[model samples]
Target: MKEIAKISGIAYLMIFISGFYANFAVLESLLDINNPSITTANFINNHSQFGNGLLGFVMMLFFDALLVWSLFGLTKSISKNITYLASFFRLLHALFFGIALFKLWNIYQLTFNASNSVTLQHRVMKLLLDFDTLWTVGLLFFGIHLIVLGYLALKSQYIPKALGLLLLLAAIGYIIDGMAKLFMPNYIDYKDVFEVIVIMPSVIGEFSFTVWLLIKGFKKQRGLQNAKFV
Candidate 1:
């Protein structure tokens, strides 16, 4: 449990860092929503922008893959059934995101193909928007994983109950936010409010869990309860 927790914590941190850089630093830097022409020119002139974003996504995927089994190892002993469910959801999230990476890569392809065309900017901008939507779609599965994992954490004596509760709240926020973005027509109007109400807690909860796992590791269960849970 200790080893698994440590591994998962490190992987979690890697995922956070790489994902943040990819979205905020690389992707946001290259893509200009207000002026797609600028985005296209930048990408054509400096392919390194795309390269760095791709690298970040690759690193995130690698760490996410590691985290899947490490998390299973940490929680499996608690309840094999619930652990499998949570792991399954998380793997699904990873799979969806892996598939979504193609959309991101395709942005480059579309950019190159449309370089000589008058509609290059429009096409590339549409693809970027599509990739963003795809990312949110993957987060839907991630939300489910968090909910199940939170339940397991609460039930298990090794993990903190407060962390479990926070996870649950975070999962709710993710689900609500993702669903609104994917389905609601006027989502943008309330997006900022949603960010404060939902996204903030989710970030806080996940970051707290990561820190706790790294610092404290997993505590051992004991006696009949431990044996039964295991």
Candidate 2:
């Protein structure tokens, strides 16, 4: 169980890193008004954009699988039936990921035909806008799932309470940010500010939790082993 937890943790951490670069450095630059100069865009397009996006998608797939595994592991670690609820939320989480993955695929398709044609550009821009809308809705669902899962983790003795707390905070931030984008799309781009302040901290917290899990596994593993010995 410990070994499995460690492996899952490492997988999730990789997912976090790859997803961050893809979203922040690639997609955000494409959409945000605060993007760098054309030279920077050229450098990214020439050097690492496709690779990063592909890698991020692969990592996210692995992360989804690992999250399923972790849900089961948490069930065993805590010896509780509430993990059924956790598992349900995990499924919702995977669904959210699927939506994002589909959007990524559309973006990749658009990349292939990127040219100075007005029609193609307009179509691509519409796809991007739709992608943004889907992502916002996905985040709302994902955030609710996280809050429920985080509460379950907090109640369990195997995982650290800090991780659960961070997850809860992340859920709250995501909910607020998603809603703001949905309802007040013209409210001074609070989404950008939320990403820097609230979202980044949540990412850091999850990163820390992943590192801890990868390094140490769950706290109850050794106790369970000792109990077996006795």
Candidate 3:
């Protein structure tokens, strides 16, 4: 149990690091939602960094898979059936994210085929928007996974109740922000507000949970009495 917890913690850390590098460092500046021409120019000039962003996604996905296995192993002793459900949701989110990466790859490949700048700009912008929209959809599944995982943690002997509560709160943040982005046309007007909503709880809850997994780890379960309802 402890060993799996440690592995899960490390996987979580890598996901954060790689995701940050991909989304913020390599991709953020290149994106101009209102101006496809700017985005096309940026992509042409920074194709190497764009490829690096894809590489970061590769690393994040690899560690993300590791996290699914480790988290399942770490928590199954608490409730075998429930843990399976949680893992399945996470797997779905990962699948969606992988598909999103394909869209990004299409955008990156455009860098090599930019002989027609006008067409390339429009194409790249559409792909970028598609990638963002698809990722928002994936966040919904991720939120659901977090909710179940939080509930399991809440009922566990070894996991902290506060961590469970934080995860639950974070789940709400993600689901709300994701739904808003998909359904609300005025989402841009409140983008900052929504970002903060998701960021605050997610960073605190997920980061603290990761640190806890590394530092304290989990104790072996003595019985399933606590998880009989599962």
Candidate 4:
């Protein structure tokens, strides 16, 4: 159990590192939200960097899949049924994220052909929109997964209640941002505000949880025997 906790924590850390680099550093850099022509030009000119983004997502997905198992192992002793539910949501998030990556691939393929610049830019823009939509869909499931995981953490003797509460707040932030992106037309107007609301909680909460898992997750501990949690 201790080894599993350590592994899951390490995997979580890797997912954040790779995902941020890929999504923000590589992919977002290549995209011009205001102009599709410029975005297509970036893909055609910086194909290597675009490929690196794909590679980064692949790495994130690999670790994400590992966490799906290790997290279940870590939490199952607390409540087998709830742990299963949490793990299922995380798996669904991974599948949705994988489909989003597929959209990235289609955009990357557009770089090579370049038969019609106008048509090419349009297709790339559409694919970029598709990727964003799909990723937002994935985040909805991820938010639910975090909520359940937070509940399990609160019931674990090894986990801190403070950290568990932070996880719940972060989960709410994620769900709010995701729903806004999907349903609100004026989301762009409030994008920065929404981003900050989500970022503050998620970055602090998840990073704190990762540190705890590395430092104390291996210690021998027991789950709460409360009937409500079980």
Report the Cα RMSD per candidate: 2.3, 4.4, 1.9, 1.9
> Per-residue lDDT tens digits of candidate 1, residues 160-228?
899999999999999999999899999889988877766687888898899989998655435325633
TM-score of each: 0.90, 0.79, 0.94, 0.95
Q: Show the colliding residue pairs in model 2.
A: none
lDDT of each: 0.82, 0.65, 0.87, 0.89
Task: Please tell me which predicted candidate would have the highest TM-score against the true structure.
Answer: 4
* Candidate 2 regions with alpha-carbon error over 4 angstroms: 32-48, 76-81, 219-230
Which is the winner by lDDT between candidate 1 and candidate 3?
3
For model 2, residues 1-230, the per-residue Cα lDDT tens digits are 76777776877777777777777776665553433233233333543575576567667767766777775664444534555666666677666666766765665665563543556445555665676777777778777767776776576656678888888888888888888888885845565686665577568666767787788656455555332110
Q: How many residue pairs of model 3 clash at the backbone?
A: 0
lDDT of 3 at 93: 87
The ten-residue window of minimal lDDT in model 1 covers 219-228
Tell me the lDDT of candidate 1.
0.82
Q: List the residue pairs that clash in candidate 1.
A: none
lDDT of 4 by residue, 53-144 (tens): 89999999999999999998888877899999999999999999999999999988878746538988888888889989999999999999
What residue runs in model 4 are displaced by over 4 Å at the alpha carbon? 113-116, 222-229
